[model samples]
Target: MKNSSAADSVVLGPRPQYPIESVDNALRILLLLGERSELRLTEVAEYLGVASSTAHRLLAMLHYRGFIRQDRRSKAYVPGTALTGVAFSILQQFDVRQTLRPFLEELRDETGETVHVATLDGTTVRFIDAIESPRAVRVASRLGRSMPANCTSTGKAMLASLSTERLHQLYPEEELPGLTEHSIRSRAALEREIAGIRRRGYATSSEESEEGVSSVSVAFPAEHSALRLSFNTAMPVSRVKRADIKRIAELMRSTVDRAAALLH
Candidate 1:
């Protein structure tokens, strides 16, 4: 999995009423394990945007819970019995990631950009899976990360399906936090953009969530008030021409349509 360069990445979604930093950090550590067989203390610290000592405590707790085990020699933590058991149980039921990865892969191949499958998680959008573009210059995958619904094309695409009252409820604040200067910073702006998304059947962001990155996205299960889903093709803003955005958005819209049917 790929991540934004920012080490101090915060949850960009609507702030939780009773957020627990420790639990969130520990969950982040588990997410990192999905991309590698093992993790070092330093890597966890950097990824979680925490100090090495803080990372160590989180790792120790996970190790005690049988979710991870530190290798005696390398001091790297690997998945443990409890984690494996949970994975086996989940996979046996149905692997949503496995079922949807091919669609993202196809989108990446068509657009020559990183493709992500994200789901609405309350006021946030969670990237459940992603396929990175193989190009030397391209946006990185965003697997297992969540961002504000209005800050990302993937999030906005889904948010467009929601009613104004619903959106207002989700974003009760007049002012919204922004990751970059280009991000939507108010409820009115987001609602206006969402109106355009509804008209265009797609959503876009130019350096909204991250500097120098732009993306075009389409949502599935069109207008679903619940379980709204979406995918986006992200690339360097410099490489994103108007023509390319149109081409990519068309392809993504079609792919998402098929995916919505298949998933249903």
Candidate 2:
């Protein structure tokens, strides 16, 4: 028994004891990259509060794996095409568009608005599929477009799924970007908002992304994949009242559930 205990301790020593802090820092770096097109090594190091050498090491590793890249002439780092490629592969690998087409069409039919399927790409949301309404006044989102997480209902739905510990780790206690007057600016306030979203089971945005447009979103928990899928319907503010938003949430949740089932 003594020998066995000693052997077990050696094996478990390699296991992570401080996963939260490390992951939190890693996520912060990713979030910063999402808001900007590119960053230099010194800029990333300053942002992470690490030594320049340490940050360069981390950046180099990410670049090596195709998660990030640096412009040769500008010497600035940008989110690599690897992420976009992975996003494409994810949709194709799961054949999500083919499986979810019926549900998306149904959502557009019921809401008379533009419906979209989006996935979390790092701290941004990327639209995988979209169906536009027949009305000329309806809002529309382009496929493959990536938007800031703090600025969209679909992004908020995914953010709502993370734990408070995880959320703080993502935003940190320092400066959080505000793209519009309605964007979440403080980590604490955002945490409360995220908690409320978890309780309510859906997310909403009113002109956070763009003025005169509103959206509501829900997430789908598919069995086979660890990643959650989310969908949203964008409409003109004139056409999207509080009750109408609620109805859209209901329709989106139902459709997402069906899509998740088929996706799995």
Candidate 3:
């Protein structure tokens, strides 16, 4: 049988071209590696919910690209030097972590609470930097921790900047996870809250992401032209009283403007 030419093989509506599975697995692998310095193939497979053979194939590809390497002693896989190089490059140039560390530190000094900078990655927000509070009873949120966007002030602040089209594209009217009683579950309610954030120029979550914890966030403009940088402050509700929201919001606004100017 004669094979069809390449031009004749073009039949589709919108086509899916990117390696979605591999990319998802890659991200999952990176997340797992960030949590632990190393992982076994079985553990990786279990984490990704893929067959051992499939996991091996993905791991082999990553190994080839120097994203993951096999240890000589433990025979376990870990992030490679090349990945570190890529991460450094990203941090030096574009990652939110590097861009906002100084600002976060300043904010921490000003507020005396844990200050964080976070950005949206899919439906979750990734904490890029954190400055710990000096007090004994402090709320510790570390860098690289991914939390639900719908239940976080930083996440909401970024989400508020999105257009309705973009919001729909990012989160469909489907099974939105609810972490606590304060979690936004309905599309209408979420839309309203996001609109409020846009109007108010900040976001607040009252024990939505965690019990007895309150967070305030303001999004800063970044060079990406699409992405938004969020400044997050997590403190006890008792500490940051209702009377203090205005002052905190003012500080966030000033710091974010300065950070944005620095980036530009």
Candidate 4:
């Protein structure tokens, strides 16, 4: 009779019967690689409770399939281009509208104004989602519309989050185009406004993008990778008084913080 070692006697509790053992082991390796930046064969073998030779064979298969690559210097496994494509594809399937609409709706309801989620597009800000105010006299919904990033509250908020070098790259010229007289004209002027936004933790546009609309916006923290986004509440200048901007800005900040938490 052969004597069993502690390793051989150790039992893993119940697992699904339908999964193929080899495929399951390979997937487990893939998941482990996803969590870690790099993995050595010895580490993989220890992690999976398998022989070094078995782990090497699994890694070789993954490398051949383009899901993993070996570092020439370290001989450790890292995610490959194929894995990046898989991750991007999975991210593309995430519905931003579905995830953010409830927050926009809640903001609109609370503020009694139009709420917008805008993302930067070149020198412009595109409105990706909106919830219109219930009041008949509210600012018109700008969903599907694009406006200059230098002029809109949401745009300025996102712009303020960018680095100075990036800002210069985006606006090489001295002057930026304006939709209204209120719109920022010079890069220097825009920079100053952005400085204020950074200090205040939010931005405001007083008829800058449109004749009658005024808005207050706050940029989402830099953690969101899918888009550089901001949340704004727009109202007719008649409805949103000067004193109201402070209250609305605070509300926008709180709502954006909650939305950012949900995203993570």
Model 2, span 1-264: residue lDDT tens: 011212123233354776675454555566666545467778767766778897887787778878787765457776676855775686756667777788888988898889898877646788888988899888876577888776788888988876564455456555567668887767776667677778878999888887888888897763434455788888888887788877778777777766776666
Question: Which structure is stronger by lDDT: 2 or 4?
Answer: 4
Q: Return the clash pairs for model 3, or none.
A: none
Instruction: Tell me the spans in candidate 4 whose CA falls farther than 4 Å from its real position.
Output: 1-93
Candidate 3: global Cα-lDDT? 0.77
Q: Which stretches of candidate 2 lie over 4 Å from their true place?
A: 1-63, 67-87, 92-94, 222-224
**Residue 184, candidate 2: C-alpha displacement in angstroms:** 1.8
* Residue 246 error, candidate 4, Å: 0.8
Which 10 consecutive positions of candidate 2 have the poorest summed lDDT?
1-10
Task: Give TM-scores for every candidate, taking all chains together and pairing residue i with residue i.
Answer: 0.64, 0.67, 0.64, 0.65
Summarize candidate 4's per-residue lDDT along 1-264 as a digit string, tens digits: 222233333347666778686786688777676445578898788877788898899999999998888876556787776775565445435666678889888888889889998877557887877888899898888888888999999999999988886677668789999999899999999999999999999999999999989999999987654457889999998887777999989988888888888776
Instruction: Give candidate 4's whole-model lDDT.
Output: 0.82
Candidate 4 backbone collisions, by pair: none
Candidate 1 yields a Cα-based lDDT of 0.79
lDDT of each: 0.79, 0.73, 0.77, 0.82
Q: For residues 1-264, write the lDDT of model 3, one tens digit per residue.
A: 222233233335564576587776776676666555467888878777788898899898889998888866557886676776576447536655666788888888988889987766556787777888998887887577878898899999988876786576556665577789888887777888998998899999988888888988999764432345689989987787886777788899999988888666
Per-residue lDDT over 87-135 for candidate 1, one digit per residue giving the tens place of the 0 to 100 score? 6445335655677778888987787788887777546777877889999
Best by lDDT: 4
TM-score of 3: 0.64
Model 1 CA deviation exceeding 4 Å by range = 1-93, 222-226
